[model samples]
Target: MRKPIAPRTIRGRLLCPRVDTRTVDHLADGLVEIDEQGVIAAVGPAPAGCAVPETVPGTVWLPGFVDTHVHYPQLRVAGRSSGELLTWLERTVFAEESRFADKNYATDVAADLCRRFIASGTTTASIYGSSHPIATAVLFAALDRTGLRAQVGMTLMDRDAPPDLCLEADAALVACEALIARWHGHDDDRLRFCVTPRFALSCTPRLLEGAGRLADRHDLPIQTHLSENPGEIAAVAARFPEAAHYLDVYARHGLCTERSLFGHCIHLSEPEWGALHAAGAAVAHCPDSNFFLGSGVMPLRDTLTRGVRVGLGSDVGAGRTFSMRHIAASAYDASLLRGARVGPEELLWLATAGGANALGLGDRIGHLAPGYDADLVAVQVQVSDPADTAELLDALLFSHATEPVRNVLVRGRRAV
Candidate 1:
């Protein structure tokens, strides 16, 4: 028989999957010690010769998911638009984003976005903010209140976008530098800055180059869309005729790096994939949005074989939900379209550790282990079968927000 632990205690089937993102150890009862710094000190079977304190029944604790791609400004437009990618961006996204020009509107929506992220059990996200500095400030302020970890950036575009969203290349770079100074490592490095150029279409070569330089100066993470739709691809090809391909545009500007995170690399060529892998850049595989928009399914297996890092993304607005679990299950479906199926363990890995690694934050968060932030969520289910762990995991991924996440913790404090 296992002995009891004396310190702060909670009893339930503890599923502490290792950092390797492999098998889970099912501790029928476990103890998790939260250090004073709000980090996980230790997790193990109840220590003998001690008393168990509080027990949470019928719940499993898992590392909170890291969403590598999402748009904070897109929350207002999330499920209302339907059309091709570029069309939706113009008719729905552009108009709604213009509202960010209003400071009050941006503040309210910023709070709303944070609330929605917490509601969906996403403890960390890489977010794209609108072009307005005040709007981005409002977004950051709202996120600061949530105790969540995130990397957010002002959307930088100097051409081919709504007039309200455009800024001169120098001005955009200056604003980016200021934001990095203020929030890049705020809240003990929980909130960070990302160097974001909305996409190739929205940024000229001059702007992309400036953004890349700012990223290098601040050493910030870079994010952008790439080859999401065929039309979008053709347009980029025509726009940058001097470049060999769409990815080459960014490459030429020195935007491709290990810290770069590209969203929806659906239409990448063999050369593009090779360059991405060589540069150690990662892809945020946004499955739901791709399926919803009829964007081509990302070739996950092919990318994996080519040795590129891939993570799940909600791609909100374009994606119907903010839940990374939904992203994980959607990825499974996407895999099936290619005559392959993603196993449950692999999907969980993609949602947590894999995603964290993709964002270049592997060691900081994304596992129930020592030296990692205590960002976690509790999922409970009553089942008669022993395989309920797998069932519960599957249910978490496939169910459309029906499964209750009983509690959420970020940095050892309750978030929900």
Candidate 2:
């Protein structure tokens, strides 16, 4: 991978999600100075005696999106509308993921995935790779080339999967360890390894326990699915009859912790919500995916009121788009269907700062403030009235077509 270029200053209409207020902050005319180390040195009005550069007449600068859940191997299969979750996986997802066993094929797909991420303004994402170690390595290499921050893991499923995608517990653990050594914390910690067990139905007790042990030993984060659909939940209960509930199975295996990110938590119960809050685990709300699969809408109000951390995810393939803005719109619609109203501030927060907090990287990359990583996106704005920031944001979110992103910067270097 090539080294990033020297830092520079950018002046624009700055917009960011603030943690203190849990809202989006807009600065009509602002300057952001990045240091040589790819950190934000200062953010606000231009410094005294500093040379003021020309500003784009109508552009909005905001932190690059943080997509908390996505599947790297399923990129090609995205937008294939089929039956519900389990049937969709059997018909489309499994067949598509099985292609990743070829390293060359995986490499080619990885390039496309990274380019899509840049085009969609996603600077950071937590990715799920197919159950092939070589394929996962190829993905890391591709992401490293683009300087995109990410957490990737080899999908682990020792049972109920096609033989080509299944690995025994011991072999899976060894592969994960090797991946951790080779890629975890690589590239100045921009890349990370996650312990991903494709979810309970596909994993045996031994596999889940082994995954938890490996994660604890390496201090790595864990990602998995939970209660995405009714049939899936019933299958989990049938598979683990002794467990009190679906969450208990993971908790007993030492997988329920602050670093755990469970995706598509649509059918969770009240007690399950409490368990998540108590364990400090986070949820990745893939609303578009839920809508596509006919999965029930998640109760966003209940989850937030219970103090559980929630972030937005593309859940690509299952999710319709790579753009977090589209996901944000879906979230709003999902919330409304559940009798809750989500405003623009909350939606933007879920896409950026909320995702950072969910992935335990809030201080590093979510906000466009001093000391944060300089990951940002510049969007062309054609609003007739530039004075109303809220109106501009609403137009961007609700419109059928969004203006193309003018530029993207990651780690103080221009990425697109």
| Candidate that would win on TM-score | 2
Candidate 1 lDDT, 35-54, residue by residue in tens: 76777788888767648653
Per-prediction backbone clash count: 0, 0
- lDDT of each residue in 181-285, candidate 2, tens digit only: 999999788999999999999899999999999999999999999999999999999999998899999999999998999998898887888898888999999
In candidate 2, where is summed lDDT lowest over 10 consecutive residues? 48-57
Task: Give me the runs in candidate 1 sitting further than 4 Å from their true place.
Answer: 1-10, 21-23, 47-50, 53-55
Q: Residue 196 in model 1: shift from native, Å?
A: 0.4
Each candidate: RMSD: 4.0, 1.7
What pairs collide in candidate 1? none
TM-score of candidate 1 on Cα atoms, chains taken together: 0.94
In terms of lDDT, the best-performing candidate is 2
Once superposed on the true structure, which residue ranges of model 2 sit more than 4 Å away at CA?
Answer: 1-5, 47-51, 55-57
TM-scores for all predictions: 0.94, 0.97
Q: How big is the positional error of residue 19 in model 2, measured in Å on the Cα after superposition?
A: 2.4
